[model samples]
Target: MSQHHAPRQYLNWLASLGLLLLLGLGVELLLQQYGLRQQQAEQQRLLAHANEVRAVLLGELNATLHLATGLASYIPARQGRIDTAELEPWLQGLFQQGRYIRNIGLAPDNRIDFLYPLSGNEAALGLYYPDLPKQWPTIQRIIASAQPRLDGPLQLVQGGRGLIYRVPVFLADQRYWGLISTVIDFDRLFAEVEAVARQRGLAIALLPLDAAQQLALTSTPDTELHLPVFLAGANWQLQARLLNPQPPLLRGLRLVGWGLALAVSALIGMALHSQQRKTSLLLALSQSQRDFLQAFELAPQGMALLDAQGRLLAVNQALCRLLQQSPTQLLQRSVMQLCVPAEREQLQVRLATLRFGHNDSWFLQLLDGQQQQIAVECSAAILGQLGSASEVRILHVQDMRERLRLQRLQSEFTASVSHELRTPLTAIAGALGLVNGGALGEVPAAMRELLQIAQANSQRLQELINDLLDMEKLLAGKMRFEAREQPLWSLLQEAVLHNQPYAAQHQVQLQLLGPPCQVAVTVDGQRLAQVLANLLSNAAKFSPPGSSVEVAAVVQGGHVRVSVRDQGPGIGENFRARIFSKFTQADASDCRQKGGTGLGLAISKELIERMHGRIGFDSVEGQGSTFWFELPISVTKPQDAST
Candidate 1:
């Protein structure tokens, strides 16, 4: 038994060794990552400095090239070729013109045919060939292609101090010809950069490619540049420059690196500590989520996510309860699919507003699993995506079936009342017509007056019935709306004329207010006229004898408001709220005296409402009531007014 225990001791030793190996591996990984990060940081710093100098280098080359190109337009009278004699004098005069145009020349037929520096000697004009291989290839290409070709220093012959730029010539006819070229002196070209850097206490030098190697182009007696240079061509070079290479002790990277290492070590220890406690925290969070999800699913209203296209993304139990559809079934289903076909178009159009990142909303009647219609109000809002393909949205849905059902029932009752009155109305009308025709001979004078009264009351009743029917039609969306722009004042006058007889009968003075402003509003003329007549007639009826009834129209803030006010006892505050309700007359007793069916106000309200106008009453008890409605005025100037 004592010998067998040796295996267990060996296993304990192996466990300790594994732990040590893991610790070593982690430290090595951290140090390796630290080194990698340092290298990356240094590279990034170098890149930043490089970018700053890039513009300066390219600008110098461009300036030299522009000076040479300026020669093309100088010889306007000549053909598509440069006059060497004139070009030499012209270029020599412009020697110190730009940053780097040190010399200018013309090359044609694969040879340096003209050098501005040697312009004075006619023998050297075309005879002294650069004969350099680099010059010939570009020269030939320029002649063949009829385009400008730039050549370089390419180790300037006989130790010249500049870069050369060559450009092809073309006359007014755009014909191709020989090349005009220039060489920019490097030392003077970059003198400004060096002066600025030195003035700012920065060590600076013009580094260039000399004999295919990076060398200082300027004569810097003592100062040195540690900045790196990049060569783009035999002569062109790019460099990254910085103010200071060695930062001060506090600013030095050695201390910063040590500080960062300590901070990282502390972070690692804290991270380990946090990791040890993560199990409990995660468990708590998971449990909380479980509780939240349970409550969310049990909410009374439907919940869903929608894309910008109104397609469903997600749903909850409440949605299932409302639509009687599972989350899986609802996924990818468009709002159109849930609503009736007729309603789908409207919903789709409204939802399209979400494309502008605005919230869209509509109430819709959807067919449930049993094919029964259920009303719901859905509001959608766009939550724009991270980038480009960014058109996602969210949807909030609430069941409105009960509210809509109540409204339908109310409409049905109104329709029923209108239908019920028709039979009595017909009988009364027929009897009154028979009496008017004198079928019943020799009636008393007072009796005749009574019969006339009866006939009038009966007609008033018929008009109310018709108004109720129209209201129901409009509510059911069975009414057609025709909108057009008509002359505002003319329409108002016509309405006044139509209701003038009624005003006379009521012994009321009706008048229109405001100037003849040429403002037109979009509306259904027939419907709006009917609305005006109803209001004016009511005002005339309510007015005291010899009192005035005002029917005024005004344009304000791009809206047309038409108001009818009666100079009679105004509506009491208590009755104002229900005055527009169907069959609810504020002055119930006055209904008999005024000979009204009480549906006029309510119907007028609905009519104006459908035309996107608003109706309201401002009243003060015992004084007067001003019944007003407003419609959007057409601000589109008449075609003839175009400027």
Candidate 2:
């Protein structure tokens, strides 16, 4: 009955999870869409505000230009000279009509000859227009082109920022005269623009399109909208940024309403389903009890039921046959009486815990009446728990002889194969070495290259055999470790010196950077050296010519970490997952061109684990890699300095 209903119950739970996940995804997507709409509206509003600000600013400049135009006609036509007495009254009336226009001047021959509001602007009375280097180019252009022009927000000779507007003056005979200029106080002009920006919740900045120009006026804002302004034929940008803008509250409330509705609906449906499930479970329990009784009696493995006191209450036919006893006779014995004397006391203690819901399995030798024993794996579970009087437990036992025998056979096969290959591989390597070393008399240069290839491959084969043997010993728990306290600095120096010749062959240098003071760690010194050598060889193999491999030791957390860094093409994403597996390489062709048994990192991981250390690496695809391992600081007494 349980077997039939279990899948339906699991399917119901899976459907509930999927429904909740889909609802959550829908809510997230809907919220994202609403957020996008709000952003678009904010951007459009900012753009509109920028346009309005530009209009207000352009109006101010045009009004000043108009005043300059009206005054230009009243200037008496002459050769580069202006009459101050005649122009003073007219300029005074213009200034009185507006507060933003600071002063008006008529300059002839590039010299200010006439001025109004002269009390504060006395410094400009005799100032030459072209003398100021910053404005000289624009001033000359206005004179040459005979056009109305604008320049500044510049530091005036008097004080304060001034926007100078100039329109070229001409005699009635078309002779080139100087110019008429109006000075607009920029502070007054910007105040008007800022008033509107404050009311609209925005910040504004006026920037020149020309990077070399020095007019800098800015305001801090959250989001930016840039608008192009053509001021007096000069390009500028008016940037408007919104102030802190809040999302619409109605949308948030609607989202919350939808979420609550979904949760409420799910809860109501779950309540109804749970009521039905309870009824189904009750029916299933009764039917399941009957099915369990039948299976228990027919099971092929031995099964037993025991009371809380560990006395056998019942035994299956299988148990009876295995013990060569009748069920009635087995029921008379307790669990302790069925175990060997050495295992009986321990089994009794295990049974005490096993009666309280501990479900771990145990291996024991169960004795029969004739005093013979059978090795079996036993697992126990509490069937009923109401103290010793009412508590009952069941035990399942399986024989493990076949599984142990197979494991031993596999381990022996691996060891024998590795041993058989080592002798022939060593003889082949020695013969190739003798031929390549000119021991058989001077050989042709062509034959020398062939002998060298043979010698290298033979040597690689010998290394492969050695790695296989080491892996076998580790798996069989036969590898011995002699861990002792050794200074990490000395170990690093030895590794660098040993790998220096091999690094030179590949044109890679090995450099050591050690800590300021010696730090000691418990490790097998010879095995640690092997790990370092393997890393150095791999680093050199993948590195470009003339690159260097850096070895460093540093204290991290509570352990000392030694790292090897190489500037080489890094590990690829596809091969990184299994990089530490035995007989694995990033590229199989690399094994052919760069020659490796590919068991180096795997063996290194095993050796480090035996010494209670950890090994890992960090790599970026095109940059390089850093492989490191950390061993705990030694707690043992320091060794003699010489050793």
Candidate 3:
């Protein structure tokens, strides 16, 4: 009877194998369908976003063109000696209707005929702001083509932000009178793309003129993402990628759900007919075990099974390929042997933190068989195998050395370039400051104007250099903080006094308020002074003559808080988000009209943080802005403290 049942058992096992194969096929088919659907949905969403942005941009472009054409016709009506007093105010009103528009200017005859946030029609009536100064070729191109072009990832003449926008204008019988362009906050607009992507849990990046990995849209201080991303939507290439892992498994299960029902029904029918239920169940268990083994061996990542004591129990083929060594040589090695000698202890501690059932992922500079320090990311899980009494630890390691190397190189290059540029900038700025301050003696109006231009550009250059340097330091973790005991109130008073004359020159009232006592902080004196100076300078720049700038410092929550409030045209809500961003000015027209580089607030923020402090600001449009920062309380260092 036993011999007769053997073939029957074999037949039952084959049936189970057949069911497993069917299940596998169903899973694959379902996964494919799911992936296809996901791709289609993503594509549709991207297309929609692109269309929306395109529509908005087109509307803005058309609005400006209509306004410019209207303004240009007025110039001809007045026989080319246009009086902005009649037309500029109307254009300013047009600009105020759009939230994204920073400032709009109408330039005629290759000069700024009128530019705004009109104190009146005369605000920049005769002033040719460099950023808004007539882009003659651009105007000619528009006149020549009448077709709109996205002119930049260039700094906006208005707010000093890098931009890309639509330009269209009017012409008289093929003569380029002037052009109208809309300055879009390209970065912020890109964020809108990111926000949509984020809603769907995706990664997004905006490339510079079709070059991805140039700069990132995300706000992380110094992340260098080098991955290539292309968005088929928007006709604008994408520098962003989004990843979601949940769908693949969900799709597979959908397929498996269908197949499992059929297999189970078949199994029950066969059992009832042949009296082979026991044999079928055993075969099912074996097939399941075999499938698990296949998944393990063919894993995409390097997989290693190590004992509780850190000895490698087994290395999969993936692991062998990664380490560039055979499994035989790796068998007795400790998990720590894969890491750099200095980092082994940390890895061991992290590994020990893993309980019998848990795991975590972390990154490190690890050593491979070639003895190279390669950047690697490891994810580990503790598992229990039936043959082993102790739980085994499985780790998956992937090499990220290339990515790390690229980031490091960028950081180093940024630092080197900043330093190289600073020397000349320092000399130039000092010269300009001296000339502007009468250190170079009295000057004629023409000479003074020329010097002013040079001085302004120098300041812009300095700001850019400083921003680069600060970014580099932040990236390299070379940012140094100096904290020392100091009278906080006294420092605030000193800052106000130093800026007093400067404020008077701008006709802004400077006031200081603080108790005549010691409210000290442990912070860098020079850096603190810099923060205060920058705040005061910005206040002076924006404040109207006769308006007051309040400077106050107080002890709040065991920290020293200082603020500078300016009564001026308030910061617009649109520009507030990037108030601390480098190389960005508050308004498009203001950026080109005013001479200061846009790096001040960014530098101040970095400086304050390095001094164990934080900075912030508050503002409202047409009401002005208030800037402030906090530093830890001054403390007495004991003699035993290490240097």
Candidate 4:
């Protein structure tokens, strides 16, 4: 028997070794994938940084070069004549505005004629362009092409390295005049670029495309992104890379993966060689039970284990504190004893169903140790095999008193504020109306216009307050509706007439279309009219001037569908989900331009739903939108209504 078991032990060892190899391979593959993703993300980030640096460099170069162009334009407007008194101040202004300009020079007939601030730049004065063999060809090219060119990060006669932006001037009759050269301090400009790169922990280089202009700036290796920079008829390449390319955390993760594989393999091998399989299994089960008990004890909500008979097997601390009872006093006690007598029978019936594998949740009132009732939401589920003698159930209870109390307080506050503001607003509106109507005597024309404006604003404010009150009443379950069978056509006609003046104010026409039919629906007439008015006014406001808004109705199966279509910019994809939310507008500027409190749609939706209907809309971004609502048709037909 010992010899036969030896081979079985060797097989188990071999299996453990194979498991280790598989786990190691999987971990290595996962690490490689993660490393590749990190490298790609880093490259993308570096590319963005390189583009930003290129834009800043180009912006600085263009701004400095614009001064040269401005001077060229100014010289020609003066008919190719440069006056010291007029030209000095202009050049001084340009120099002060341009932070990176070294100096400005005007070369007439291919010779340096005038220099701004001749203190340090006196050496550059009276120098002929033809005398400098290196720059003469570039200046000649600028004059022939009649275009601007940026050249040189070369040594300047005035001292430091500088770039020259040369703009050729011409007369009104297209005669060649001279060149306006603006010297830019190359070192100062690049200092700013370097500062930005250092802030992002990146190294950057700028390489000119022209090989003849061999001025290249570079840093370390490991190039990541190469972006093009175009300015003043010259192209250059910008390269960027991260300072610390590889992160240390990735290396640490690789080492951790290998160590975990080795540890797992050694544990399995030891377990196999022990020859006490039952002892090892028991140890694992004990550990799992301990973990579960620790989690149950620390849970925030009340939790408990109950036997098949509904007696408490074990209770966590949260449950003990919730009931104001100790574990010693609550052990083996029936959980139903904690509920009020009025609800105990119902609770028992629900708990009995848990054994049959039916999970349930319901609201209940529990009595604490002092016999005080507490409102709670309770749920139960079977914890073990169904119908087994040792089966247990888990119960979860959450207190709901605080949530209900806060809701009541919020509703009361909204009602109080809306009522208080409506009274004063009504009085102000009435006074303005009387004054504008000449009831207080003949008024000046200017004062009458001001009074009318005040009246309009007061009216808008009053409408907003009314919408708030209606919304509050609906949310509080206090809005009363008088439902009756009514013809939908008459309601639509009344809404059209009511909103005609509003549509005319926005210069949009309203058209009522569809085949004539006597479709009646059971709804509150007043509320239904309000919903129609909201859709009509909204469509009219958004429609372009002279565009038409169409109101139509159709019957489908057992419901009547009413639609309001408009020729207006449709809703955006991002804002469509929140279109009916409280105080939400597609754009904030729409509130001031379109004149709304942003609560119209929300109130309309609530009112329609309260009247037993559904409201929705369909829209394409640029075409337009159609708002529609459906209401169940009344059982009483039109002919029956006449009876």
lDDT of prediction 4: 0.83
Candidate 1 Cα misplacement greater than 4 A, ranges: 1-319, 325-373, 377-424, 436-439, 444-457, 588-595, 635-643
Residue lDDT tens for model 3, 1-643? 9999999999999998787787877656655787778766665554454444444444554554454344445544555455657666676776766454555555564455555554433443554434554444554555467565555556643345533333343444555555444454566655565566566545655453344333443322111222223221112434333344233334223545556776667678977867676778889979987996687678877888778888888777877887788888889888888788888898898888897767799997766688877778898888876356487788888777777888889878878888998998899889788988897688778888899888877877887777678667764667776667766666777788898897888998788864543566777777788778888988998888788899876668767678888888888778888988877787657436454667778888888777778989888777888899887765653232111
| The 10-residue segment with the lowest total lDDT in model 4 | 212-221
* Candidate 2's TM-score: 0.45
Give model 3's clash tally: 9
Q: Which ten residues in a row have the lowest lDDT in candidate 3?
A: 219-228
Model 4: per-residue lDDT, tens digit, 1-643?
9999999999998898777677767667766887778767777677777778887888888887776677777887899888999988888888888999888888888788888778888989998998999989888888889998888777889888888888888899998888888888888988899899878878877766555333544333334655666677767777777887766334544554556666577678878767587787889978977897898888898988888888988888998899899998888999899999999999899988774567799999998899999899999998783233377888898887897788778878878988999999999999988888889899898788788889999999999889888888888889999998888887888888989899999998888895754778888989988888889999999999999999988888888889999999999999999999988887777335777878889988998888788999999999999999999887776632223
Model 4: colliding residue pairs:
none
Off by over 4 Å in 2: 1-400, 442-450, 543-546, 567-581, 584-594, 618-624, 636-643
User: RMSD to native for every prediction?
Assistant: 23.3, 23.5, 22.3, 16.4
Count of backbone collisions in candidate 2: 0
The whole-model lDDT of each prediction reads: 0.69, 0.81, 0.67, 0.83
**TM, every model:** 0.41, 0.45, 0.41, 0.48
Better of 2 and 3 by lDDT: 2
Residue-level lDDT tens digits of model 1 in 243-342:
5443322322334345556656888999998997898798997897689557656767777766777777667788887878778888888867887888
Predicted candidate 2 versus true structure: per-residue lDDT over 1-643, tens digit per residue: 9998999989998998788677767776766787878877777787677778888888877876776678666654434455667667777788876668888877878888667778899998988977888887888898888888778777788798888888888877777677788888988888888888878887787766655332553333426756666666566777788786765535433454577577668779999999999999989987887788788889999999888788888788888877788888888578899889999988888888763656869999988768798888999988884234477888888866677678778768867987998898889999888877789888798788888888988888889889988988988889989988787777888899999999999999999874442668888999999999999999999889999999988888778888999999899999989989999987788336677998999999999989999999999998999999889977765454335
